[model samples]
Target: MSQAADLPAEAPSARVLVDFDRVDLAYDDTGGNAIEDVSLTIREGEFVAVVGPSGCGKSTFMKLVSGLRPPSEGTVIVDGREVSGPIKIVGMAFQAPTLLPWRTAMDNLMLPLEIVEPYRSNLKQNRAEYEARARGLLKTVGLEGNEDKFPWQLSGGMQQRASICRALIHEPKLLLLDEPFGALDAFTREELWCVLRDLWMEKRFTVILVTHDLREATFLADTVYVMSRRPGRILVRKSIELPRPRDLEITYEERFTDIVLELREHIGRIRKA
Candidate 1:
């Protein structure tokens, strides 16, 4: 059967890049589902954030999207195809920078090209081109002067920034961020949020960010989905209607706070349930 046959006819005809239809995941042969009845769709170039209480499967959701784990039931589709296993179309960044401490920032960014195909095979031949590309990405993320520095030489924010550059170096169609800035100081954390916002605005890659921070979700996502407690399900899908080119100043405004509060209420209700 065709993909269209999998859904109701009344559904909008917009292009959907990621679709999870009543998905579920189990860790063992007879274990209970980690997440159940999961269904959501994300379109190309859409910036989406997933927020939830602790142990609510927010990270599990990211894993499902990236094909890091197969669903015990239901379909996991992306870029118009079902995800059976890990695919090259995804770029992932976790809470820790996870950069190779021995390598320079520029070298770290180029790491993906060494592991991925086509680029990996041609890395030697395209040395200059790839180096330039790495340099360009470094510059884009404000890492120009520190490209030669090792991971430890960079601050937490800078290392995370480098991690993002590394993830994007392959130019994957989808970017998965799992609390990439959660470990940073408050000032640094917020600073990286704007950095991320600017990067998303410029690159337009599809993003599925799993974060605990409500304000971060409100500021960065075009649409934020709130998940319930374990066996997680989307409880709310709130669209961030704030205009683009957003700045830190916008976060203090009543409108932004209202949305954050609204999401918080939903979480509180989920917890209470």
Candidate 2:
């Protein structure tokens, strides 16, 4: 509900947060690019959503940003630094919760803190402080009392909350979510949407979410990008200027539907192409 400043009014020249300049990606033995000549810029603290057909390189884009795969040509830069390999400043979560079954919810949330940075080096000495932070995040996400339960004890939605808490435990600068709510039922998905919105509002971390849901993009992103079919390239760049602190009721508004329908039409055209 609080208003955080949106991305800068003008695009950054050298200070761009994330940039893909004529980026092309292909496997060594592949005959063509999975993503081709794609160029885009994401400013610091921006929430950008990418939508496209299956196998349209949405996942490939995530891999590229996380530095799991290097571009076959051109460049990718994040935080004014060239992406060379797996970036430590990035945290990721996907559709599946992927929580280790044996780990309790709080333990699941603490995984990143135990593995990353100053916390990792001081985990033994700072265990209590880190645990309190984890508990606080869980409470914020409505998972306060469930921290001691194992992943199997939680419902799909709760498990996903744990997964997101895990991703943010170390407080990375960039959050990469690849359809993190895709597997949940519609009601649960919407509930988590508010949870995610609140989290992003509180932290203001840059987010790159790859989702097939146009409504989700409209609800959460500052900008929505549509990609062409395989050998994917950005085909549309639409900005959503909807008033912030968006409620589920807003999805019923004409303005919201207009944006969703426009994005829908774009996706339909891509599917036919």
Candidate 3:
């Protein structure tokens, strides 16, 4: 892992990277807002998690941040700019790995660079450099020596690791994840948590994770936002103050369990309401 000094000197929390002010999003077919009066600020490099009842617009929030959906009202600002269309500075991964079946793991990781700007133009000239980067990222996620294998050849966890690497290969300023680990087995999911943790600690990019798992939120997020049922609203914003470079062992501690229970209670109340 790279030392902290390898990154910029600025404090990771020093700048506000995402701002949602009284935001509301409504679907015409649904005839009501999916998200309402949602207001929150996410600082640069902060790990934020959104948790709520099944239809509480947690995924809707991801869409807004990534510029996939426009708000019906209020502004959605990211990296100091009001989003007008799909922004280029964000990367996303979902519950599915979504790697191309025909492409090798290395080729899957290179897909974004082939489509996204600057790199796309320079790809032919910098192919070697990009391949080296892909290899490094694969190694980081324990996919070393598996670069030439096709997606179908890799395990579920390995495929997801490649999926995450593909999202990150572009080095975006913001990473949006919607239940990225929801499909994996419990042990693999926890292992990947540490993988993500190390990557974030090393790179200091902003992350917005939407998940149903309270323990995942509590264990990985700097702050966890609990939303109300439908027409979602921010019900609670709980900051996890546990020490950094968190280990899997911390999840077993009393403080960790308490925080998870608290988040669970908030969701339980929303579900019952």
Clashing pairs in 2: none
TM-score of each: 0.93, 0.94, 0.95
Candidate 2's C-alpha lDDT? 0.89
Task: Please give the lDDT score at residue 15 for candidate 3.
Answer: 79
Q: Tens-digit lDDT track for model 1 on 1-273? A: 012222211213357889999999886864767898988888777888999999988998988898889999999999988999987888999999999988999889898999988899999999999999888888888888998999989988899999999999988999999999899999989888888887787888889999999999999887788888987887777777788778999999999999999999999988888
> lDDT tens digits, residues 52-158, model 3?
88888899999999898999999999999998789998889999999999999999999999999989999999999999999999999999999999999999999
Ten contiguous residues with the weakest lDDT in model 3: 1-10
lDDT (CA) for every model shown? 0.87, 0.89, 0.89
| lDDT per residue as tens, model 2, 78-193 | 88889999888898999999999989999888888777887899999999999999999999899989989999999999999989988888989899999999999999999999
Error of 1 at 174 (Å): 0.2
Superposed model 3: Cα runs more than 4 Å off = 1-12
Off by over 4 Å in 2: 1-15
Index of the highest-TM-score prediction: 3
TM-score of 2: 0.94
